[model samples]
Structures are given as C-alpha cells and as structure tokens.
Target: MAIDWIGFSYAATLALGGVLGYTRKGSIVSLIAGLFFGALAGYGAYCVTCDPRDVKISLYAAFILATVMGIRYRRSRKLMPAGMIAFLSVVMILRLILSLL
Candidate 1:
C-alpha cells in the first residue's frame, strides 16, 4: 500500500495547530477539536493508504471542517485559524474528489 503523505501531513498540521492554540490562548476547546479531527484525519489517511478507493472518512472529515470553519471565517472575518483551516479543508476536499475521478 502506498502512503498518503499529504493526508498524514494535514493530520499533523491539524494536531500541531491544536497544540499551538492551547499554548497560545489556553483554549482547551481548540486542543480537543484539533486532536479529535487530527485523529480522524490520520485514520482516514490510513484507510486511504490501505485502499485508495475508500475515501469516505477523509471526505466526511474534510467536508465537516470546511463547512464549520467556513462559517467561522465568515462570522469572525479572521484569517489565522478559521480562514486558513477553511481554505485547507476545501483544498483537501478537492483533492479527495479529484482522486475519485
């Protein structure tokens, strides 16, 4: 099985973001959310690595993050966490979709 390096990198980025958020702002929510989603992404990557056609977990995770972060970015008009994450999520969604084609 081939490694899904991009997906793994995304998961690491997400987990790191969470850690950064906690360290910078002491936001437990950010930590939890980040780790949770990171784990989900990591697992999804594993699934994709084992079976490239199985993208359900990764797609769902990316879609959820894109929707939620997009809303947050829209409401807050901030670019750091929300906007960046939303953009990344959208990119991931696109990547996943393209892989199916």
Candidate 2:
C-alpha cells in the first residue's frame, strides 16, 4: 500500500501545533484538541493508505477543523494559528476531494 505522505504530514503538523500551543500558552484545551484531531487525521491517513477510496474520516476531520478554525479566524482577525490552520484545512479538503475524482 502506498503511504499517504500529505495526510501524515498534516497530522504531524496538527500535533506539533498543539504541543506548541500548550508550551507557549499553557492552554490545555489546545493540547487536547490538537492531539485529538491529529490522531483522527493520522487514522484517516492510515485508512487512505489501505484504500484510497476511504476518505470519510479524513474529510470529516478536515471539515470540522476548517469550520471551527474559520470561525475563530473571523472572530479574532488573527492569521497566525486559526487562519493558517483554517486555510490548510480547506486546502486539505480540496485535495481530498480531488483525489476522489
């Protein structure tokens, strides 16, 4: 089975982001969220590696992240964490959709 490099990278990024959030801001919530979503994404990647057609988990994770982060970006008007993650989530969604086509 081929590895889903992009998916894995995205998962890593999310996990790292969470760690950073906790280290920098001491936000337990961020840590939990980051790890939870990261694990979800990683599992999704594993599913995709086994069968490219299986994108349900990955898509749901990305959609949830994008929606939540997008809202945070809108309210905070900051581009560091929320905006960047939201943008990445959107791009990931697009990539996942394209892979299906």
Candidate 3:
C-alpha cells in the first residue's frame, strides 16, 4: 500500500491538537471537538489528494476548522496546540494555493 504522508501528517496534527486541547483545557468537549475536526480534516486531505473530482470544498472546511482551533489554542496560551495547528493550517493553505497553479 502506498503511504500518504501528507494525509498522515494532516491527520496527526489535527489529532495532536485535540489531545493537547483536552490536556490543556481539562475538558471533554475539547477532546471531542478536536477528534471530530481532526478526522474531518484528515478525510478532507485524503479526498482532495486521491479523488480526481475536485474535493476543494473539504479542504476549505478543514482550513477553516484548523484556523479556528489554532486561534482558540493561541488565546488559551497553549503553545503546542496553537503552534501545531497554526503551522498545519498554513501548510494546508499553501498546498491549496499551489493546487490552483
């Protein structure tokens, strides 16, 4: 099976964000939200890369979610989640921009 590193990284970052969010916030809601959003974004990355039909919508949603989470983390003064999500969001945004070229 071919390894999808981009997809893996996307998923990992989101999942990590969730874990960190839960750890930092000490709330189950953060955990659930993180996992849900991570899975959604990871699936989006998979669809965008593998599917021939433009799955750009998913990428947009993922980006938005990531950005929101990143801001949340930042506001909470949690460095890891904030930094991870911020970087991941930027990378995804760059990838989306490049795909347009």
User: For residue 69, what is the lDDT in candidate 1?
Assistant: 93
Candidate 3 lDDT, tens digit per residue, 15-99?
Answer: 7767876788787876887787678777776766676245475567557866786787878877565666777777767776676
Give every collision pair in model 1.
none
Candidate 2 per-residue C-alpha lDDT over 2-81 given as tens digits, one digit per residue, 9 for 90 to 100: 99999999999999999999999999999999999999999999999999999999999999999999999999999979
lDDT of each: 0.95, 0.97, 0.68
Model 1 over residues 36-85: C-alpha lDDT tens digits? 99999999999999999899999898999999999999999999899999
- TM-score, prediction 1: 0.98
Ranking by lDDT: 2, 1, 3
Off by over 4 Å in 1: none
Evaluate model 2: give its lDDT.
Answer: 0.97
**TM-score of every model versus the real structure:** 0.98, 0.98, 0.69
Stretches of candidate 3 exceeding 4 Å from the true structure: 1-3, 23-25, 73-78
Q: Give the least accurate 10-residue stretch of model 1, judged by summed lDDT.
A: 53-62
Tell me each candidate's RMSD, in Å, in order: 0.6, 0.5, 3.1
Q: Model 2 off-target regions past 4 Å?
A: none
